[model samples]
Target: MGCFAFKSKAKNQRAAASGARSPAPTSDGQKSKASSASTPTRSIQELSDERGAQRLRVFDLDELSSATNGFSRALKIGEGGFGSVYRAFFRSAGGGGGGRVVLAVKRLNQRSLQGHKQWLAEVQFLGVLEHPNLVRLVGYCAVDSETSKHRLLVYEFMPNKSLDDHLFNRAHPPLSWRLRLQIMIGAARGLDYLHEGLQEVQVIYRDFKAANVLLDADFKPKLSDFGLAREGPTEGKTHVSTAVVGTHGYAAPDYIETGHLTTKSDVWSFGVVLYEILTGRRSLERSRPAEEQKLLGWVRRHPPESQSFRSIMDPRLGGRYPAAAARQVARLADRCLVKNPKERPAMREVVEELERVLQMEPPTTTAADKDGDRRLPPAKR
Candidate 1:
């Protein structure tokens, strides 16, 4: 999940440094082949040069330390399987005395299972790939000391944190139905860009979950955390044969069972998040009852077009959502969650369906809508 650390008023004197100037933009023919590989085998320098004019900064460890207050505990905003994230503010030396810039610095845990390899993968992919929905990598830090190695990544600070916090955290006001649809659309566009927007490379977001969807000040959704991202199947290849690596309950069943990854795997995970948006519960929650613990299983019990489907609507919405739109979303989710990978709708199709649903007006609340509130308690699972 995206974390937020407020900036301390103290001025950081550490001078920011920029990497070597990138060469002029290269033609598509000159682009490196390493990027299209299933695993990102290219180094940052290689990819950065290939990007041509898109230079990713090489951050100094001491400068990052000063920005983060020496990695103080109080500044930590969030933590995940990979490492801890700290919010920081530092003046841009390249700006020539401009105001301090905010950043989210991710410090990799030395003991974690994914260390250098995952870190490098992020640098390789995000260092060159640019999109409105993808998080911007401001810079990165790799330091070696006598005792240990320190690896860090710097990204643009997402002010609103993650979609997970807003959806499931009772502390925050519940998301309005329209707002939920807006966020989903933005996220779908991001996935679409990865799958089809790139010239020849199809980036499969291996870990597509609510936590990875970070929101900015305007509530714009941006996909973050590329540690588990991979390039999709190459020419003539049906799928990329690799070990399955993704969050539990979010990975596609086919990939989880056979270790054969494809773009369809990401579609499955997107469907899970779509359900989470409809019903404020998480994809997987062990604290609840066994039957309700798995979101997919619980949702399946309430099929679309059946009376039971109303039970899946988030009660927090208070019948303010359009019934027709909700049904359309449910049906879309059903298609996305189909058992056969071939049966699932492509992300582009999912985006178009969402756009159509967004255009529909919410149904006027009637006796039946009110009854929906009483039909099922908000899914705690």
Candidate 2:
């Protein structure tokens, strides 16, 4: 795959990091090395004035430090390529009389691969794009001065952590078939909004995977980490030619080969996660046997009609899930993973398919239902 084949050497270097943020220049001298590289034709400043009017609050460093217990290890909730995230609680300005809010604070490491530019990109995207499925950005801090330099962001805390925590971590109980389907549908809605919801720009969530999907207390899924998001091609353009930057297994093959990205690329990543939801397996497991390392390739070998398809379903389900629903989802996955980008169904179509799968089983009338707890019945379609 020509994953690194950029139009120029500078572009190649800019796309080097798997999760490189947009190359918008920051106030600090740390301007993006590839600021002039290919990008969506529209400038960031061109975003709607209404969005810009809702400016993010600038927090005092001392207050944030207090909130995070001086960035203590005990409060740390997550760590990734960007930096360390901490769980914190902040009270309203009036002290105890005012309500308290829970938040996740991300402190960017000065030495990390992503720096000021990426930080700015996160603020720019999340600052404006508002959706029920997209994580809310509360505020930010940029301490760029001659003495001390620090970059941090505050977000609404997701008590349930990430989808990856539930799907891949052995400590948690396995997600029920109904819950898994719900989560996938929620994620699809988020992607659909990004692809078509905005009036001025088509936002391509370059990084779409389970790890980036956060779940709330009620198991509602929200898309987080907008550092890799990009504006899609304008009218008459087929794709936005830019550097390839995303997680390994979830990125679309066409994007990897040509650096040409479209909404279809996000669809490909969505398909990978759909399979992960179905099988409870990671998209890329290096330790597995060669044939089984890549979940998509291995699962594709067993078409939904084939008897071997049962072998690919999550063993944890113990055959409790509806077979017809599983088969329908598997077919949708096949459509999303097609080699040609054009062949992949749009996010809207994917949402409709998932909704249809949800309707395949009739409502339950078991004792659980009478008690006001309705559980999905086995596949009878």
Candidate 3:
């Protein structure tokens, strides 16, 4: 069952973050590893079939149960429509030198048919995909029998939670302007890699949103949640005409209307998030006044170059961010949100532009310390 079937009105084209069919469930069996040769070097299926197990550890149901305290509610740290994620610590397969590893375990909801598909997608995709800005799938557990079903994934535990948590939650302090730039750039670079850095395959990250961008101890951003990722059109095909599915606000208009999946669709979502970081507002916030209910419609009224643009800047920044850089970021975001998908800048170009944003010198006031003699250097990327 897919989310958001094609509708008559674009407004009616909203989407769910995850829901898709899959190859009939993979049988419950574990393969012993050969060696560490998995890479995005070959086509997705080729890599998954040949070497995915080499890169992933197969956890027995008993081990995962013990590590997660029998899936105790107290240990759960995150959950969505599909499943709940729990924090756990388990010793490595090599008990002597490996010590205990802190991990995040995601357990699928047995009732959700879509959850099973997503679990398989994560197992196959994350098993082969490796990058500093991507959450590592250390292992997985699958048990499907007549009496019980258990599908779970174990990932390196991210200490800082997600960008969405920090950006919107009041508990955490606001991120420094430089830190914000560094984080988004890392995320965009990850997207760039998915789109263009691979050997022969180009991945379209259909779900690109702050919630999916997790943060580490140092606040570096890593894009997680590969449930909706899809391969780009190949063999001269312009787009992958498939079911429209992704977070409603982040999905591109072209994809929503025509099921035309492409790298540009992810770029469009990245643009929405760019404005989000700058404005500290969600794509759609109904609690806000009618004029500001929709972020894009509201922001168009105040172009980045206009004098009122500063009013839209995240007040949490406390006037510390460079005014010029903010305008430039907004401009880049405008290019990403262009109605025509073809006109949107590629992820590589967007990343290069943001890198330049870091090189820019900040105004004295924005960089000065309380003493007014020293300057805060740009945040380290």
Candidate 3: global Cα-lDDT?
0.76
User: Residue-wise lDDT of candidate 2 within 1-381, one digit each (tens)?
Assistant: 111111212322223322232334432111121112354434343552235335566566677899999999999999988899999879866786888778999999878766656676677778778888899888776554445467788999999898999889989766777767777887899998888776556688899999999988777889999888877775566787887889999999999999998889999999999899888899999999999999988998999999888899988765657889999999999899999999999988998899889777456343422222222222221
Candidate RMSDs in Å, in order, are 8.6, 8.8, 9.7
Check candidate 1 and list the clashing pairs: none
- What's the lDDT for candidate 2? 0.76
Residue 13 C-alpha lDDT in model 1: 11
> What TM-score number comes out for model 2?
0.84
Residue 134, candidate 3: alpha-carbon lDDT: 86
lDDT of each: 0.75, 0.76, 0.76
Query: Which stretches of model 3 miss by more than 4 angstroms?
Result: 1-42, 92-99, 361-381
Which residue pairs in model 2 clash with each other? Answer: none
Per-model clash counts, in order, read 0, 0, 0
What value does the lDDT take at residue 320 in candidate 2?
Answer: 59
lDDT of 1 by residue, 270-295 (tens): 99999999999999889989999999
Model 1 — which ten-residue stretch has the worst lDDT?
A: 1-10
What TM-score would each prediction reach against the true structure?
0.83, 0.84, 0.85
Q: After superposition, how far is residue 19 of candidate 2 from its true place, in Å?
A: 22
